[model samples]
Target: MGLPGEMRVVEISGPGGPEVLVPAVRKVPQPAAGEILIRVRAAGVNRPDLLQRAGSYAPPPGASDLPGLEAAGEVAAVGAGVSRWKVGDEVCALLPGGGYAEYVVTPADHALPVPEPLGMIEAAGLCETFFTVWSNVFERGRLTAGESLLIHGGSSGIGTTAIQIARARGVRVFVTAGTEAKCHACLELGAEMAINHREADFVAAVKDATGGRGVDVILDMVGGDYLPRDVRALAPDGRLVMIAHQKGAEVSMNFSLVMVKRLTITGSTLRPQSVEAKARIAEGLFREVWPLLDTGRIAPVIAESYPLEQAAEAHARLESGQVAGKIILEVA
Candidate 1:
């Protein structure tokens, strides 16, 4: 795998909207030890990319500064100490950043084989959302069989992943989406009940769905005001794993609710986590979830794909908050 001279990338010139993503050509990257170079076929567009564009979320220390976090393609080359994968292996990876380009370098351990059942586009869309949900909701939150899991934004990438993974594990799911249509989409994907947050109070609806017992775990992306209602909606010993603070991070909430229910609150970002920590999660996912993908029990729901040159449009679509599932960019 001889390295190419240069690769085309969609880059953010400065802090601003989607229009700020400008196309540029840069020297192809060389993989460091334990890293692999991928000929990027496609990249996933996520909310964090939008935030990075606005200068709200910067790349974690030592991670790539470019925007895309998930991508799928073939391993064109491998660096020293990379024994598990070789050149020409079809792989998809959860990149820390630098995916909105023709080629991106990633730690070989973060790369997973794309199942033959899933095409490159769908594989491109899996890494970020599935890794996030598997780590936060199941691994950390401890969602169990016969237990109930509540997910916010049920039609978004993470929401959709949580729904399928929980369902496959025999856990009942309740999700909140913005519209009846989105709610119905969640139901079709296996949620026990889909609440239209705009038309009904999710707290009451969740209670009703569980016979007033409340859900066992909640995977929340909305912070601030949702914190209180999330507490009210928990079952005894339940967990609320907050992943993002889209509504805002600060909140005034009662501690008694947390104490009375014996609730646990925790969250983590993949980029900032130590490599050893992520490697642990990757192992768990490999043992429990990878087989599902191998057998087709779980797969990514790709809502749309845009060309690399149209990267700005992909960001704009994500900002609209109307995408049914993961939106991806084709690097070619």
Candidate 2:
């Protein structure tokens, strides 16, 4: 199929709230060498998109100002030297930006073939959270079989994926969510225990669930006070991987506990990383996670979806803190 001369996209009209996301038409983007132009069928709404809309996070240099970070679609065009994909191949990809458009260009290596059982809509929500969880929870946190993990925000996309993937690998999974319903959802996704943070103290709950040994790994998004609590929740030689600071960045924690526990604390932001680094992550995901997806051992959990023109509403829903899984924007 031939490409269009222009495509519709959701642009950040100004830095503010979800209402700032407005629909606009732009000239179709051409992929440079090593990139491919995708005809976007759907896009995933992420917390970073909200941060970008609020002017707290900015796209990296040379990336699109559009907010979406993941998309699923068919290849429409390929740039020179891009041999991995051609017209009509269906794929889902982790994008630097610009997924809110009807068409997007990304490094060919960032795109992966959609799992056999998933359609474009569900596949659309896979890239961002899956990549983050795989890179942080498994690679950085070093969670392995026979170990245990504590996941904050357990009903969100990242939490759900981590829960299933870790469980599939024989790792015990514990999670904390904002509501009882969300907690139950996490448990249904193979978590060994799910604590409702609004009603229970997660640190206490995790300690009790682990018989006071504490967990071996923690995937934390809420920083601030959580930093100290997370420290208290880890066992000796444990790892705490911080991905976001929804609470706040600054914190006061006991250095003595960190030293005594021999814990490791680390984090990373995916969009700003080099193409080679992301390609390495993509390779790992394809080799390890994709087979699990194909076998139905792991999957994307879609909470809701909206039309491309209603991108603002999708963002609003994501910001509402009521969604239990991923939110998608249907473009095609």
Candidate 3:
């Protein structure tokens, strides 16, 4: 099949609000060696995308300035030296950038086959959150089966995925969300208890839930004052993985707790990592988490979707902080 010369994309006209994302046409990118061209069907809207749109996060060198980080689609073309996939194969992938377009090129190894029971739309929401949760909650945090985990932002895409995946692996999951409805949604998705952060003290709740021993690991996206509480909420040798600082990055926390408890503090951002590193993460997911998705033990929670042109409105919805899960853009 012949490829189209031009494709539609959502571009950041200027760094500002969601209204800056405007539709425009651009030449379809050709995949280079070790890369594959994907005819994008859907793209996920993430917090990083919002940061990029607002000029707080810049795309790394050689990455497209477009604002999407993950997408699902069919392979449209294969570049030289690529072997795992060919035209017409369905895939969901983590991208360095450029997922907002109708066609995107990414390292072939970064893409995973769409799970058996999921379509392009749902698969679109899978890569970013799953890869993030796996890398942080399991790999970095070292959360193992039979341990307890505390997840902040439980109603979020990352939180929802982490809750289910951790629960499926025999890890008890506790979560904190901003509202009662969001907390309930987290509980329904396998969280042992969902604390309404706005009303309840998460540190106290976690301590109470774990019999005052504290959780074994915590996946925190809300930084700021929560850092001290997160430190206090961990059991000895517990791991605290920070992925974002929505509340604020700076904090004043007592180091005595960290040292006395022997807690581990770590964090990572997905987009800036090297291709080889991300490919390794993809492999891990293929072996460990994909089966859960295939068997219906876990799944992506889609809050809403918008047409590719209405990317601005989608951003508005996400920024409203009312969404319970992933937001997506339907491209094809």
Candidate 2, 95-185: lDDT as tens digits = 9999999999999999999999999999999999999999999999989999999999999998988998999999999999998899989
Question: If scored against the real structure, what TM-score would every candidate get?
Answer: 0.98, 0.99, 0.99
Judged by lDDT relative to the true structure, which candidate is superior, 1 or 3?
Answer: 3
- Which tens-of-lDDT digit does each residue in 109-178 have in candidate 3? 9999999999889999999999999999999998999999999999999999999999999999999999
Q: Which lDDT values do the candidates have, in the order given? A: 0.91, 0.93, 0.95
Please provide, for model 1 over 249-302, each residue's C-alpha lDDT reduced to its tens digit, 9 standing for 90 to 100: 999998998999999999887777877777777778888998888999888888
Candidate 1, residue 28: lDDT: 90
Q: How do all the candidates rank in terms of TM-score, highest first?
A: 3, 2, 1
Listed per model in order, the count of residue pairs whose N, CA or C atoms clash below 3 Å is 0, 0, 0
Q: lDDT order of candidates, best first?
A: 3, 2, 1
Error of 1 at 57 (Å): 0.9
lDDT of 3: 0.95
Please give the distance, in angstroms, between residue 150's alpha carbon in candidate 1 and its true position after superposition: 0.5
